[model samples]
Target: MPLFDTHCHLDDPRFADDRAAVIERAIAAGVERMTTIGCADTPDAVGRALDIAKAAPERITATVGVHPHDASKLDDALFAALEAAAHDPLVVAIGETGLDYHYDHSPRPAQQAALRRQIALARAVGKPLVIHTRSAPEDTLAILRDERARDVGGIIHCFSEDAPFAKAALDLGFVSSFSGIATFRSAEAVREAARALPSDAILVETDAPYLAPIPHRGRRNEPAYVEHTAALLARERGEAREAFDAATFANALRVYGLA
Candidate 1:
């Protein structure tokens, strides 16, 4: 079955030395397409993400937006850069942006402001969004609704919320994406959340260099291992692995506007 890693950070420094090899492995493992997120963790992350997509245009695409952690840095210059990046041919969406109250790396207010701006950017650009909400579901949902995000739709990347949150996002035309977290013993609730969503609203990712699935847990992640999460998600949803994989792949394409 062909797979699609709907969200990943291929621009992360961990893959700098051998990014090409990583892509090869993903393709070998049946991942046909991958969307590399351009979360503005650093000032130049968005540009770097587009560079990575340019390196392998046929199999990769990118998104451009500031991440919640970097919310404080979303200055006028950065917003201008992001707006310009949004028009890049390789850019498929606008974000990896949203609220992250867990770390509070950037204050809550800043994250919310950044999220609203990015939501507007996504709508203005006529592209979808790639949201990163954590520990702030209520605020996230409020902002999404307030910003009328349903107009462009998007994916709630690396989702870990329960059914109610999934329902809320689904109501806004957003889909829930699963990551290696879905394979964790402690992530039973996450799997349940995956089960709760309709098949077409499900997408999978590795969020690589981060949450690698079991058997490779605690180790660095990469796109090839998305299959493990896909396997778990398929079983939890009581669907065939091949069908689940194909459906999620198509879901990613549809959300990213590639379909």
Candidate 2:
């Protein structure tokens, strides 16, 4: 079955020299669709993501928002640009937003404020959200609840939280996206959580140019490597690879409103 990489950053500078080759490789590897995210870390990040998606509209889509790392930089002008990017036919979601206390690149309050604003934008634009939370589950869940994120739904991208947290997110109508981290031998906890989640509430991503899966563990990641992560997740869930692929592809389309 064909595969889908639900989250990645094709606009990362690491992909600059061979962006086309990377996309082509992903397609050849049976990665039927990809969603490249624009965290608005830099001035041109959103445009870069859109251009990549536009280059292959049928097989790729893009998202726009400010990352928690850049939370302090977010302002009216930036949000306006993000909202404008969301209007593009190729734009399918409203983030890579949420709290990231592990890095603490931005202040905690700034991260919270940025997350809330993006959640509101997601609701306002009627699009699903793509969240990133690390070392801040309580605050993440609380803010999500307070902001009524359940109404619009979204994915907990690269989920690393425990089972109860995953359950809480599921209860709030969010899907958990497993990344290459789930394939790591050290990630038994993550695998257990993936195994415990409802099949329909699960998804897979690469978070590429970041967490490269086992075997490729020390190398740079790209969309084509998502198959490796998906394969491992399929095995952990005890579903046939084909079945898992179809389910995740459907779940992704549904969550992103592309179905």
Best by lDDT: 2
Per-model TM values vs. the true structure: 0.98, 0.98
As a whole number from 0 to 100, the lDDT of residue 109 in candidate 1 is 88
Local accuracy of candidate 1 as per-residue lDDT tens digits, 92-174: 99989999899999998899999999999999999999999999999999999999999999999999888899989999989
lDDT of 2: 0.91
Off by over 4 Å in 2: 42-44
Q: What's each prediction's clash count?
A: 0, 0
1-259 in candidate 2: lDDT tens per residue? 8888999999999999998999999999999999999888655565778888988899999999898999998988788889888888788888899999999999999999999999999898888899999999999999999999998999999989888899999999899999999988888888888999988999899999999998799899999999999999888888999999999999999998889
> Relative to the true structure, how large is the alpha-carbon lDDT of every model?
0.91, 0.91
Q: Supply candidate 1's per-residue lDDT for 19.
A: 91
| lDDT (Cα, 0-100) at 215 in candidate 2 | 73
